[model samples]
Structures are given as structure tokens and as C-alpha cells.
Target: MENLHNDIYPAIDPSVTKSLHQPGKVVLITGAGRGLGRSIAEQYAYACVASIIICARTSTELDEVEASINKINSAVKVTKFQLDVTSETAVKQCFEAVKEKEGRLDVLVNNAGASLEWVSIDESEPGKWWNVMEVNLKGPYLLLQAFLPLLVETARSNNTVVDVVNISSIAALLTFPQSSAYQLSKAALLRLTEFVDVEYKDKGVNAVGLHPGGVVTKLSENNDAIRPYLIDTPALCGGFTVWLTKGARTWLGGRYAAVTWNVDKLLSMEEEIVKGDKLKVKLVV
Candidate 1:
């Protein structure tokens, strides 16, 4: 099999021309303190997004990301919130805070995730499996439930589409050894993405799942099971995310995409992708 991580994709360079400009659009990214999440936030800052709400469990990390984004563009409003996405109450309060401050939310990136144990099914404990599910799957569900009202209202009032980008993984599609928990969670996440798109597309809310490639992040670097694979830069996912937000790509809702795939190449095949029902999760009969 071809190595999925071997492919090179475009990176988001601050010096290059910005392709996504959401001048007054407000975006909220969970787990945005570092790694791919931080890269995503920085990409948005360069695109001149009006307000960016970054949330994570650590205040110090959040502070650093906020400061970094501010240094890049002083005008880009950065709000750092210490949040544990696994908590329903915290998710509710965070959304309420964003509602009070921004009046609306234009984009939501459910990027918080964890892989507790990489052991095979026989060796995996229930507690460890549940931990992965709670963070990767349930966290996004709670976030969507809490933020949907604001997203719907914003899309209706503004005559624009709201976006929900779930940071999923290629593990959801391929069967890899000793990755039961992480793979299950990601698979369910893709289903949740599809359900959100089907239920809310008519209301102007679009949702999609993104496989961020095998990026060398703290998560992957620490996991001995996956550290040896060829990895892509976090900027690949960051740039692809910005491209996903553009209105022209609304048809991509309900689909799953990989950052390893070139954005321009993906866009060029948009019509065929939609018509063929490609890039969507389906059970192979």
C-alpha cells in the first residue's frame, strides 16, 4: 500500500497571498493551544479573521498562542478560554461566552482529541477506551449541541453559511493494529459529521470531517506506535482548513478529506466528487 503520509501538500506561508479572508467572521477552535490547532489558529490570523476564540485545558499554553496571534496581527481579536471539552457544562459556558461576546459564531473547529492507550483490543481496558471516546466523539457532540443555535441564527441573519470542521483521522478508514480506541472514536466522528450536514444543510450549516494527515505533533511524537511513519507538516492541515471554509466549497459538507491531498486538485474535482458521492464514509458491502 502507498504511504498516505508520503505525499507533500501546500503549506500556509504568512508571506504568501492569503486565499481565505473572513474579515469579520468569528471562529472558535478547541485544543487550539499548540500543534495542529495552533497552526490552524495562526492560519486564520493571517487570513484576517475578526475574532478567534481559542480554548484548551492549559491557561499558559493558551496565553502563548493568543500572544503569538496578536503579534502577527494586532487587529485580530484573540480570546483564550481554558476549557475541557469532555465536560458538558464547560462546553455550554464556553459557547454562551462566545455568544455574549461575538453575538454569532461563523466557524467551529472541534480539534480537541486524545488517544489514551494504543494497545490492541485484547489488551485494552474499558477505562482507556472510554476516555478516547469521550474526548474525540462525545466532546464534539456536546460542542455541536451547545453551539448549533448560534450557528443557525448567524447563518440565517447574515445570509451566509456556517461551518463545523471536525478534525478526524485516516485511522477511521483503514484498519491499523493496536489502534482500536482511537480508530473507533474517529470513525464515529465522521458519522457525526455526516449526520450534522444532512440535518442542517438546509438551514445553512455545513459540517465536514478532515483527516489532518500523519503530522508530527506532540501526540504522535509521544506515541511510540506511530512515531516512525512519514509525517506532513501541520501547515498542510491549517491551509486545507482555510480552503475548506470558502463558500465555493460548500458542496464538500458531509465528506471526509485528507490534508495530504492538494487543495487545488481537490477543488478541480469538486463536481465529480459530489456527483459520485466520493470522499464520504460508507460501509463496503
Candidate 2:
């Protein structure tokens, strides 16, 4: 066994700040209009990513996020697309545009999701419950299906690693009354991450599921029933995502991680975690 204390729990160094720089990379982020998605885009901009394509259902929100990113780094090529992730045709068009304009995509962030009514299973409206699934699980499925070929192609041609970062939630692991629909959707999303990684790992494409923590965003504000639990900042997930994409982090591929985990500590435990195949969804025998 590894000495976790000496190896993993080192003191934080206040003087060191981590940043990722991918000057020619192109990233596409769904739900990039606000909150966690917006923060993630901003971090990528700061990292000097060459091109960023942001898509969401609202044009106004997308425009605002684009402007914010440009202000951080005017050199970054920012493209805004108003998209409905639930619509396969719309997702296809978005990726087509990315391929036409950018030629290749380095990262795809499936951040768009919905958590409609927070009622118990029995009380939940059938249409609303299913809508959550449509956005949370089905949307990513559509995007991943549409984008995998392009990601794999880019990786093979350039000999570089590509990524799919699914913004999952801790709700996937924990159960709470009145939120079964959201919980089930996220749990399925985590499984999707594993499935994609397993299928595409050999092709230089990596997929990861991440719990963005309890960022107080419009998604949570709209659901006053769960506002008290929202405590983390969007920047936490945003910065962590840039870190995840900086290197292949092959050891962490197909796994689910929490933004609350310290990056340095997690890196320290990489060997042990990978050896044991930890931090992934498992059947509790």
C-alpha cells in the first residue's frame, strides 16, 4: 500500500498557480452561455486556446459569454452558436460548422443539462421527468455520436490526444428524495463516459465524467428547493477542467472525479488510484 499522507496530502503552495496553454487547440463547449460553462470557457481563453466554439439555446446569453471571453484574450477566436442540445439536427449542424471552420476539435465539453421539477418519482410529471433524461443523457449521446469521428480523426492525424469532458454531478452517486429524475440522468451520464472511454481509448480519444461541485448557477437558482446545497464556485470546475485537458491524464480516463478534490493531491495518488481502478462507477457487491 502507498503512504497516502506523505505521498498525497502535501500542503498547498500559495505561490504556485496552475495554467494550461494550448495555443492552436479548438474546443467546443455546450451550455457555454453562463455559470459553470461560462467559467470553463474563460479559463480556456486564459490558457490561450486558439479557437473556442460556445453553443447553447439562448443567443443573448451566448453573446454575453463570447464578449467576456474576448475581453480576457482578444486573440482567441470565439464563435457563438445558439443550439438546442436535445435536437440531433441542431447538434449535427453545430459540429459540421466546427469541422468546416476549425478543421479539428481538440476537446468537447458536454455541459448542457436540465433538472426540471424536483418532485418525488411518484409525484413527478411524466413529461418533465423524461425531459430531464432527454437533455442530460440523450443530448450528450447525440453530441458524442456526432463528434467522435471528428475527434478520433483529429487525434490520429496529429498524434495528439482529444477529450470529452462530461459535466456530471455528485447527485449521480447520492440519493435524495424528490430528485430521482436528475439523479438517474447523471448516473447514466457517468456510465456513458465509461462507455466512450472504453470504446475510444485506443484511438487517442479520452472521455471523463466530472462532478462540477455545487456551483450556484441559474440551474440551481431556478430550483429553490435545492439552493441551500449550492456552495462551490464555477471557477473551481472551470480551472479543474483546463487541468484535465492539459495532458492526456490517461490514468483518469473513464473515471468520475469531483471538483472539490485537490488537483495536486489527486495527481499524487494517480498511481495508486489507477492500480486499484478507483474513482469509477462500480457494482457494490
Candidate 3:
């Protein structure tokens, strides 16, 4: 029998998936092959997103995710691209493919990561830091650069906005001596989020760093020592991310946030979760 790494019990709520109903909106997700990415993709597919572009390094893995979505709703359009997000050429090609297939792109979820390994900084080698930076920071930056045109076009042509949600970590803000490289990259990712917000705010493109508080996944399951402290699940993170994109235009952007905190804002009625497919907007008029 294969080893079953059960870091979290499944408590998936499909109701959280109702945010992606823009009729013809297009979404592209990195690292959609497994873990939280798979969960996020499942929820988006369930919401009847117009088009979902799933990318990962393994063609077989991408195919698996695509096939799984097809099983749930065969009419939902899912395009798979074999990609290593760290490569600028690959990122450019993937964005081009999205432009070709979808004509306009509406959302991007930067979920690809490289800092899955857990080891004391003292025990880690030099290449570890480089690998983490390459995937976590460089990849997302390249994706944003390559896709900015499509995002701008989407906003202008369709009367819809573009969202870039960067999946960061609490480790970025809190000290985690075990993985310094991961910490540094995620912190920089938050900065990148700020830059995106500043540069694109006037253009109607919203970007933010979302810290999915300790979601159980392959990285967390592989490390037995730190798994106990994590409280959130992939499904919860996925659900929150989809909703975040739906309403991030009104919510403050360019800062780090978590589901636990944002959901509390909803519960306390500081922010109202809008009904139907429209984004929640604060009344200023």
C-alpha cells in the first residue's frame, strides 16, 4: 500500500466556488497540478469560469488535473500548458498561448512555489536559496510582466478587471529560522504585490499577497515537526482565494492578508460578502 500523508482532513465547501461566474472571463493558474493549486483549480472550475489555463512542469500531471475537471463539468474549458514558471521564455510562451486561446485574460493566481523543502539553514546548502528565489520570486515577477498586456487589454475591452493573487506565506513576516531563503523570497513577493498595486491601481488591475495560513499540502505533510501548528486547509485557502479575486478591487490591496483575518472581517460585517457574481464595493457616493 502507498503511504497516505494525511496532514488535513477534507472539509471542502463547494459553496465558496460561486465567485468565478463572469460568463467569458479567463483565468490562468500556476502549479495547478496538485496540492492547494489543485484545490483552487477545482473550485474555479466548479464556478463555471469561462476558461482555465492550468500549467505545471509535468504534462501527465497537468493532464490529470484537466481530466479531473472534465469529469466534474465536461463543458468547462480547461487548457493545459507544460511549463516551468521559473523560465522567462516558458512564461512568455504560456501567456501568449492564453492570449491566443482566450482572446482576453481576466485573472491570474500565482501559486507556483519552490520552497517546499524543510531543513535548518545551517544544514542547507548554497543552491537551496537560489532554487527558492528562482521559483518563488522570479517566476511570479516574470509572469506579471509577460501577462500585464493581456490583463490591461481584458480590462479595457470587456469592462471587467484583472486580478493577480500571489500566494505568499506567514513565514515571510514571522521568523522561521529553518528556512531563511523561503522567508526572504515570500517577503519580496509581498513587495512585488505592492509594486503591482501601485503601478496598476489606476488601470484597474488589483494585486495582493495572500498568506494561506498553514494549509496542509505536500510540503507541510513531508515535514512532521511543523505540521501540527498549521490550522488552515487547501479547500479553505482555495475558497478564500477565489472570493478574494472577486472583491479585491474594493478591499485594500498591496498588503498581506489571511483567510482567518479576512473572514473575520466578513463575519463582523466590516466587509460584506456580496451576492451573485458582482464584487463587493464600499459605498462612497
Candidate 4:
């Protein structure tokens, strides 16, 4: 089972999946300018969502993404924001803007993340080492702070399940040398997911930590050691995310999911997962 992996399947395919279509739901995706974020945004459009809030630091990329969404589904209302997720002022403003315009948010994808050169702590530049935390960790924290209230409100009034997808990495489970910043941040994020789920499960908010498969992108190309594992594509991330939000997957709340896991198998193991409290961050005895 350790070596096994899976890819995209019909159940999660937004373009053809009937069960996964979100007709009236609004979704917000960070780092949507390109790569996996772009793919996730596109999948939502294909899922027939009512609107998509696409955010990134680059206006040009957002413009291109907006245009692409228009081509994919002109009916999808696309909103673009040139956002730097690490900036508190920007995140709060984004929250206010979304709250004002949409009045509610059904999905928030904390997909904006950063990484730094693999240098030992002793030799690492303080700014560079900590910047990764600011982007990968602090950004999501601020977003959560700013938007969670809206999510909770939406859930209470609408009586529906809202999702928060924190994009974690497989590295969170590894102990690779010189990869401390990214690993620790992701590991902490899983705990944050737990806190969010436990705190708001009764209110219909489901927070999930997801490990998107190793899809090679601009942010990842510089690393040579992990190059071979970059065999997956952005569609896998997008499709799996759709599946995660297809309905009220409360059983999966506060858990870790990977795109490489076969959805059918994953579903079949729900009983085992729930009974054993699996897919969570824990220490081995």
C-alpha cells in the first residue's frame, strides 16, 4: 500500500462529473495566477460554480486566468485580485471585498505557499528561511482569521457545509534535511485544520489539509532531487478537490488527503478511517 498511487477518475472530473457540480456555490482560490491554483480555479468553473474569486500577486496572470475562465465557462462570474497572501492589509481588504460583494463564501482554498533554498538552519538567511513561513503559514492564518467568520455565517444561515482546503505537502510527513521550514509549517497547518474542524464542526465548517500530488511547477522546478516524483498534473489536484467538496464530507474534516489516493478506495475505507481516527497528524508509538 505504501507504493500505491492513483490519478484522476470520473467521480471527481469536474467537466463530466454530475455529482460534483456546484451550481450556486462561490469559491475563492489563492495563488490562482498559474500552476495548480489555476487548475483548481478552472475546475471550479467547469463544476458550474456561480462565481470564482481568483487571487495572486500578478495581475497579468490573473487577467490570463480570468480570460481562460471566460473561455471555459462564460457563465462563471470571475473576480480577480492582485493579492499577496502574506500581507495582512491585503488579506483583510480581500475579506471585506468578498463579504461585501458575495455576502457569503462557500469555499476557501488556501493554496498560496512558498519555499526556500534547501540550506541548513545554521547557514540559512534569516529572511529567506522565515519568508517561507510567512507565505506558507502566516498567509493561511491571516486568511483564516479574515474569512472564517464569513464562512461560519454562511453555514449557519444557509444551513450548508463550507470547506477550507489548506494545501499541504507530502513533505509534511517527511524528515528531509534542510527542509525544516516547509515541513514544519505544513505539519502545523494540519494541526490548525484540526482546531478549525473541532471548533466549528457543529456550525457546518469543514477544514481539510490536503497534499496535492507532486506536479512540477515554477516554484518546484529548481529542486532536482524531487524531480522524478513530479509525475502528476494540476488536473489531479483540481479534480480531487472537487470530489472533496462534492457533498458534506464531514468524515474527512480535519484530515489529510492526497491526490494520489484512489477515491474509490478512499471512500471504501471510510469506516476504517473513522473508527481508527486515521489521516491525522500523530506520533508513532
Candidate 5:
């Protein structure tokens, strides 16, 4: 899909009532300490979500985001977890904590990821390459396992839909040199998204794989090859996420989206996209 806007416009900004204001939802985000993760959390705060749970490896980063959330919306309850998303026990414990306290979870943003040195399979450190898969692929799976019950229950109780946004990448669809571990992990995530939607859509759960635009984050900054392409604002992905989740966007379930794509344009193309199964991973793609 062609991108109509590269940055935040009036239509998708978190302050846009028609597009972004969805109050009282409970959201949990992994990697919420910094970069696109923090951006997504902040946008949810702007939407006046009832509570937000943020998890990251660094306690200091979590503290900063909590303070930022407080400034954005003091009424918004903020929970912090110093977590490794790849740890099954930790993820399950986080799940228990949220289930006990919130009793519901409306959205899960699987944003925690790892990217080692950009080296080819032949040159890559075996341990480091495997770590990317652990964080990128297995991490989301752990989260889904831990949280899907509460998400499904939340939907059942509300008679509405909940969401799982797997933060995949453009690399999932395209190819590049020296990106096998990262790229392949993200690619598999799209299939995982599809599987989740098929299994749970009738039960009121939707999952989507997303590319969070090219932003100059701490992560992206380390990749010299993509420096010139990191032209997008951090707010673009943040606001796009708020827009995507405002309502039951089951139409977009089990597909892919890029924050750089104009959301209104995507909505307009919905019928065509659904009919042709566009934006999905397949043999042609």
C-alpha cells in the first residue's frame, strides 16, 4: 500500500476524538521502557485508558515512562514490570498479576525484541542469532500463552473484541543482506498472527502484525544501513496504534500494516483488501 502520510497528521493524532479516543481499556506493552514501545504507551495514555502495564528490562527506563504517563494522564493507572519477555515463568507471573488486579486486558503489544550484529549466517555468532529468535518469535508466543485467557475473558465479559498487536517489521516482508535471524523471526510472526486470529476471532480476539515505521530509535540507530530511511516521527506509530485499536477492527485481523501508510486510506481499501486477502503473508508476497 502506498503511504499517504509519512508522519502524524490531523486524522490519526491521539487527540483526534473521532480517530483516537477510546477510554477505559486496559493495555499491556512489552519493551515499554523506550522507543516505539514508550510511544505506544503514551498514546494510550492520551486516549485516557483506565490502566497501562509496561514491561522492560531496565528499571530506570520503566520509571521514566511511568513518570511520563503520569504527566500525560494522572488518572491513568500505570503498572511497571522489570521483565524479560522470553522468560516463560516471568511472563506467566505478569499474567497472574494482571489477571488478579485488572481482571481484564484489552490489548497486548508484543514489542520486546532483540537485534544482534548484522552479520550473515556464515559469519554470525550462533548464540546471538538464536537469541533474536528467542526474543522476537518465542517472546510473543509466551505472552500470547500467558495472556490470551484473560484477553478472551475480557472480550467475553464485555461482549466485545480484544487485540494482540505483534510488532513485526517491514523486514518480515522484504529481504536484506545480513538480516536472516531478525528478518526470519519477524516473518514467522505474521503467520503466528494469522493463526491466532483464525483460532480466536469467533471468540472475540483479533491479532495483527505491524511495522512500526522507520523511526530513529535507540534500536534503529544502531543499523547504519537504514539511517537514511528512518524519516518517520515516533508519534506516527504511536498514534497509528491508538487509531487501530479504538474500535473492534476485526476487518483488519490477521493482516499486516505499516504506520507510514495513511490509516484512512487503508480503511477505504478495506473491502478490496479483505476480498483479495491483501496485506497477508503468502507465496506471492
Candidate 6:
């Protein structure tokens, strides 16, 4: 709840902006080519992350991210890996490359996602659902399978913890009658994160699911249902991401961190606000 316009979204020259100054910690982000992915990469780079692996199907997009990150922090390492998460071989190779280059990974952000025209269960093509599942669910599954060893390796080497943040959606927690495939795919991912969290806590890898709310991105351009509520920005999402990483064990982990007010209220343990109870709140950046 920080001052959005002042502390968080103050206008500044991109040229003068610098990295976050967090050297020696590596972070791997999927779909780092555009939208939220690109923003998250920039934010992390600004934070001075030791190394950032920008993974995507487009070498050009990855290259753009790398250039942007390096421009902000030349000392930060930025590596690009072309990958199609739907392909198992590609996923394996990407992680192997990370291991070879970074030696250790401190964070993994599963932000790659896919969408299609709205379709109901009765009329939706099986292929459409399969495609959604493959990219949204199976992609993360493949990534976790391939890169989990490296996460563990990092933790064992540092004798600390690492994080895996799954980019889920409000649709995943709600009933989307039109886009059933997208909803189901994200819902499955939520369950997947839970499973990983429980299964790997002792291994030192913590996993959590997040919903960035409606944002003005390609994913929302054509989806009218979700477009209007899309008031959040990529930078805001990026900020929340870093915050979550810092407070993973205390404020997050094994829980859904959503931008939706209703979701937050529903999940809150505080008593319901009854007709203007003068609620106290804190500003967040």
C-alpha cells in the first residue's frame, strides 16, 4: 500500500536509472521478452542481481532484455536462452545452460503463459485446451523437473533458500465460464505450486503462486472480459514480485498473493469491516 505515484511510480529518466545493486544472486525468468516478464527482468537487474537468464522462444526479445539490463547495470550478468517451454528438450537445455553459466540460481520466475479465443467446454477445441495446458501448466512442470536440481544445488552450496514463483491468474481461483481452458490451466498450476511447496520444503526450494491482476498487456488486449479491471502495471507487478521474494517465508509461500481486493479480503484473518470501521492501512511501493 505504498504511495503509488510518489514512492513507486515516480517519473524518472530510464538512462539515469540503475540496477537494484544485488550482486552475486542469479535469477532466471521465463518469457522475459515482453510485458510482465520484461519488466520483472528490468527490475531485478536494477536490483543488481548477479546474473539474470532471460528465457523465451524469440532470440530477438531475449536480446532486447539483455541489452536493457546491461545498459542499466553493466556489472550484472545477462544471458539469453531461446526456449520453448512446451518442448522438454528445450527446457532441459535451458536449465543446463543456466547451471553452466551462473553456477547457482537464487530465484526462478515461471512467468510464461498462453491464451486463446474464449471457448466453452462444449465448443472448445481439444487442441486449444491442450495448447493452453502445455504452455501454462506443462511448461512450468517441465521447468521444475529440469531446474529443480540446480535450485537444490544452489541452496546446498550456499546453505540457504531459493524461490520459485509461479505466475498464476485470478481466473485460476475464480470460475471463468468463457475461457475455461485458461482458467483450468492456471488452476492446475496453483495446485502444482502447492504440491511443490509441500514436497520440497526440506530441500530448500520454496514455491508460491501469484496473480498480477488485470494489466494492459497483449494478454489483455483482446480479452474484453479482463481488460477493464486491468488497472495494474508491469512495474507494479515487478515491485510486488521483488517484495514477495524478500518476504516469501513471512508474508507469502504456500499461499496465493493476488492483486484482487476481494481475494485479499477473503484470505485475510482480520474481522470484516462493518460500515466504516476506520480501517488502518499502510502505504506500499
Q: What is the C-alpha local distance difference test score of each model?
A: 0.86, 0.86, 0.74, 0.90, 0.90, 0.75
Please provide, for model 1 over 83-143, each residue's C-alpha lDDT reduced to its tens digit, 9 standing for 90 to 100. Answer: 9999999999998899999999999999998986578788889887899999999999999
Model 1 RMSD in Å is 2.4
**Clashing pairs in model 4, backbone N/Cα/C closer than 3 A:** none
- Model 5's lDDT to the true fold? 0.90
User: Which residue runs does candidate 4 get wrong by more than 4 Å?
Assistant: 1-7
- Tens digits of lDDT, candidate 2, 39-70: 88988887788999998999999999989988
Candidate 1: worst 10 consecutive residues by lDDT?
1-10
Question: How many angstroms is residue 201 displaced in model 5 relative to the true structure, after the best TM-score fit?
Answer: 0.7
Cα displacement (angstroms), candidate 5, residue 174, comes to 1.6
Candidate 6 residue 259 Cα shift, in angstroms, is 4.8
Worst 10 residues of 2 by lDDT: 6-15
**Model 5: which residue pairs collide?**
none
Error of 5 at 265 (Å): 0.8
Give the per-residue lDDT digits (tens) of candidate 3, residues 37-120: 887787777667778889889788888899888886676799998899899999988887788878888888898887747667
lDDT of 5 by residue, 1-285 (tens): 355566777777876665477777999999999999999999899888999999999999999999999998899999999999999999989999999999999999999888877898899999999999999999999999989989999999999999999999998987898999999999999899999999999989989999998889887898989889898887888888888887899999999998888877888999999999888988872
Of models 3 and 6, which has the larger lDDT?
6
For candidate 2, list the clashing residue pairs, or say none: none
Compared with the true structure, model 6 gives a TM-score of 0.84
